[model samples]
Target: MISKRPVHVHEAVPHGDEPPGCTSRVSVEVGGRVWLLDREADMEALWERMGEDDLGADERLPYWAEVWPASVLLGRHILRNAEVLCGRMCLDLGCGLGLTGIIASHVGARVVAFDYEWPAVRFARHNAALNNVPQPLWTLMDWREPAVRAHGFDFVWGGDVLYEKRFFDPLIRLFRHVLAPGGKIWIGEPVRTVSRPVWELVRREGFTAELLTVEKVALCGQNATVNLWEVTIS
Candidate 1:
């Protein structure tokens, strides 16, 4: 569980632009259970557009915690299709909020969730404790680092990580280095055209792929074009 701190220690951004903060929340149903998240900070980031300031590296803030729709879709599909995650050693890369890892642990898998963003790591840990999920090993490791050149895992998981072009090549190379022989990787992507190259690259790496459809309806809204990919490394 997360330890409580004094309210004066941290200045929280108001939920909305009003005098009274609006309640920001998201709920997803996964593996026959519902997960509820209340994140005013994420809502503030949404209103800020995540790229508004200097709109570049200088403007980027630490701990920007927005939950993506793809995470919800893919986490559910992985739990459904994979025979048994129980007792498996899993690595969740770019594990925003650690939803997928939490679900994996819920099913008896040991999970290591990594995120480059420090804020994401903090929230992931808090969310895990809040949901009664196993407290996963959390690290602030970048996939492109040479230090991770030899790290590999039985199952690698990620959700909605293909949003930027800069990280694409590094992400693929990281997966190639870390995935064990005959291991599986799962990704959930929206119908973004840029994501096609990622799929092509995965196939070129000698993995067999198939797409699974997921129905995701969060309190924020409904996402219909969510598709989950199950790729098995040969």
Candidate 2:
């Protein structure tokens, strides 16, 4: 059972005149269960921030700030298979608002959620508190960093993370480094041009990739199709 705890207040971005994007609450339903999450109300402000100061590779993408459709589908998958995760150590990579990790924790997994953006980590922590699930350890660190490479996880999960071709090598390396023996990876992505090559690479690396499900989701007021894949090292 989830416990209700006092909400810890973190210093949020100032909303002066401009709308505060993180003020709204979104209710996400997965496997007949509802998880309440705090979401950024305005994406334009976040995009503007990303554009400022000649953004670099890691800093240019503000995609982590929004809850994507893939995350929702991934959360449902986790809930549906909660029994398999009991007592396992799970890693929610690029956790954004932390829905995946929170759901895993609720179902008995020991979860650790990490995101490259500081605001993402903060919001993830807050959302975990809101849902009253055991809060996963939240960290603000890039995947390329050596510190993250040292850790091992029984399960690695990500949502909508394979959109960019440039991220493929780094992600593959991270998967190889952190995945424990007999570990599995769960990914949810919208079918995009860049994803096919990544899957080819996964196959070449000796992992058996299987399509688990296809879900049609509403994203930014439009319907989008997302695919969930399960990969295990052969």
Off by over 4 Å in 1: 1-25, 38-40, 43-64, 81-83, 146-151, 214-219
**CA RMSD for every model?**
7.8, 6.9
Candidates' TM-scores? 0.76, 0.84
Candidate 2's C-alpha runs over 4 A off are 1-22, 49-51, 57-59, 146-151
The number of the candidate with the highest TM-score is 2
Each candidate: what lDDT?
A: 0.62, 0.73
Q: Candidate 1 lDDT, tens digit per residue, 114-230?
A: 766545555666667668977777655656662332545778877766756655677777777887777877777767787777777778877777885655535356554666787
TM-score of 1: 0.76
lDDT of 2 by residue, 1-234 (tens): 010011123222222222135677767677777887776644555667554574553444555566778888888899888899988988887787778889999999988777765567677777887889887877655666524434478888888888777778788887888888899899998878878888889889878889999989765577879999988888
* Backbone-clash count (model 1): 2
Q: Which stretch of 10 consecutive residues in model 1 shows the poorest summed lDDT?
A: 1-10
